[model samples]
Target: MILLKLFWSFFQIGMFSIGGGMAAMPLIQNQVVNLHHWLTLTEFTDLITIAEMTPGPIAINSATFVGIRIAGIPGAIVATIGCIFPSCVIVSLLAWIYFKFKELTVVQGILSGLRPTIVALIASAGLSIFILAVWGEDGFSTNPLTINLVSVLLFTVAIFILRKWKPNPIYVMLGSGIIGGAIYLLI
Candidate 1:
């Protein structure tokens, strides 16, 4: 029954998450954090970080992580399969339909319309993460004492480094990890 629930949960995520991994964050958060109570909000944010650092799509990584946490290896396999199955079917069908209707203005218009929606989804996910990182669990407090100085500093420095040097993202991640670790340990 747990396995069935896991599969159904991820299947819904895969089916509706049209834009990609970033756009899927809210849906994944809803299923795993809000609906199933598999992980807390902080854990969900950590999951997103881990998922981004790893090799595959965020949705698949999230499914596997939540499944293993809840029901071990078998849960991971079932959840992963569930997450992938919809994308496999949808992409295949869409590919055929797209090629057949490649010349239609309606198809072009539909594709154009989706661009803004996808951007909005990605922005919403990014803003949620930023708020969580800077403001703790209480969320969006205007009190100065409630803010995490370390997180704000790290975020600012990261943006500066990225904008100024445009170094490899791996280096930025590594540097941030090392700095964050050192600061947290000292504090």
Candidate 2:
């Protein structure tokens, strides 16, 4: 029963997450963190960090990780499949329709409308993660010290590096990891 619930949860994520894996983060968070209570917001944030570092789409990686946590290897496999199944079906249908109606103005307009919605979804997901990372457990932390100043500083530095040098993300991630580790050890 838990396996079925896990599969269904991811299936909903896959079906509605129209933009991309990052866009799916909000839905995934809602299900895993809000509805299911399988993982704490902090753990979900950590999972996002780890998912970004690993290969594959964030949605698939997260599904596998959450599934494994809940029900082991079989859960992971089922969750991965659930996350992908909707995209597989939707993309195939869309491809066929797109080729057939590639010249239609309605289709063009629909695609244009979708672009902004996708951006909104991705932005919303980013904002939620940002809040979680900065504030820890409580959204409104009374103690200023509880706020993760290091994370905010690292985020700022990462943005600066990206804007200035445009280095590969892998280097930024590695640098951040080392810096974060060093800071933690020192403190």
| Candidate 1, residue 100: how far the Cα is off, in Å | 0.5
Instruction: For candidate 2, give the lDDT of residue 119.
Output: 98
Residue 81 in candidate 2, Cα distance off native in Å: 1.0
The CA root-mean-square deviation of candidate 1, after full C-alpha superposition on the true structure, stands at 0.8
TM for every model, in the order presented, reads 0.98, 0.95
lDDT tens readout by residue for model 2, 68-145:
999999999999999999999999999999999999999999999999999999999899888777887788577888
The CA-based lDDT of model 2 is what?
0.93
Residue 163 lDDT, candidate 2, scale 0-100: 91
Model 2: per-residue Cα lDDT at residue 75: 94
